[model samples]
Target: MTEQGPVELIHLADSENSVIVRVVGATSAGLPGDGCLIAEIVAASEFANGRLTEVYLLPDDLDDWAEALELLAAGRTVSWMDDGRNPEVRIELKGPYISQGQTLNAVEVEVRDASVSLTAVRVLVRLPDDWVDAHRRKLDQVHKAWPLGAR
Candidate 1:
């Protein structure tokens, strides 16, 4: 993502500590590929004060969670809401990692938006990773019950 400047809030949040941003629109030159991806960010600074937090981005329809994994891998954005008022969100990759650890995994992305003022929403996500041998073995066993073609 080129240094395209600060991301503007087209659909601002309701509170100062939190804001909900989604992919309202996008632009593509269609050459080198990854054009301009946009999202309406809903973030808050004071989400909570603790360790081990779980955030959910619900979908509008019934679909597999694998879809989210696919989107994140492809650099496409998504959100929890499906009000049918905007385009599908592409995961915004342009943000700062809040964690100060030497090595961080599945860290949240924080952005400086005028809507959220001094606060920001902590966007935490888990990307795809390799499955351990033991886990894969268990999955192999489970798959046997619902084989490829057993109907």
Candidate 2:
């Protein structure tokens, strides 16, 4: 399958326990808070048909009303793993990751204040059940310590 460029990543905290991430074309789009280009999902392919075990952000072209419709689309299968560069910034989501749930079993989001782009965005799964709670707490601390507004 052919590979495509990384998508623009943006994050927003909907509430104390939930967050919203918007993935758009590799263009200069509006981002939440005051940060610019917080992080990126490098070398991401398209989402495949059937059940997905992890969170895969499908490009807008392949989705209809935010739902994937075609399996024959190019780059329909993708994977996300750590390259051992910065493991601390990796993100983790629950297994069988689906879009309809709206609430993930676990999620880890990495954020930075730099105006530059981050090369990697990691999403991890297949871990303990309680991993989400722990990560959420850590994210809360990060939000309090270095808010995107001030950065």
Candidate 3:
């Protein structure tokens, strides 16, 4: 919430099953001692035909979702940082139907400046089902129209 930059959603991989989402950001002045990054991972099987059974936040930087929620509930600022080395933060969700149809279905989100440059936000998701075809088609259409850096 510290004057966050733009949020970009990049699809890393999309198939029939499983999805990995990564949320990241770059820092220009480094991580603040009193700031932390809050990440929220929500997976719904109703839409993707899979239920969210597990969730993980990588880098072990700040606190987990529970801890973050606690702090936030107590009125605290959750700030994140990127020193250009670490992955910033990663969220992985697993479910029973994660690998039903295909074996390679993942979506990654990448956030960057809309104009100038610098900093980014990446989210990767893995979905299980035959939705890959539609996703691919959508991606193709988006690419054709935007070309690059259109997000």
Estimated TM-score for each candidate: 0.26, 0.24, 0.23
| Candidate 2 residue runs with Cα over 4 Å from true position | 1-34, 42-124
**Model 2, span 12-59: residue lDDT tens:** 222232222323222123633224323332322122111111133222
Better of 2 and 3 by TM-score: 2
lDDT of 3 by residue, 25-53 (tens): 32223544222222233232324432121
Point out the higher-scoring one by lDDT: 2 or 3: 3
Which runs of model 1 end up more than 4 angstroms from their true locations?
1-64, 84-91, 94-151
- Candidate 1 residues 90-133, lDDT tens each? 33443333444532224234443333335433554432233123
lDDT of each: 0.33, 0.29, 0.33
Looking at candidate 1, the ten consecutive residues that score lowest on lDDT are 50-59
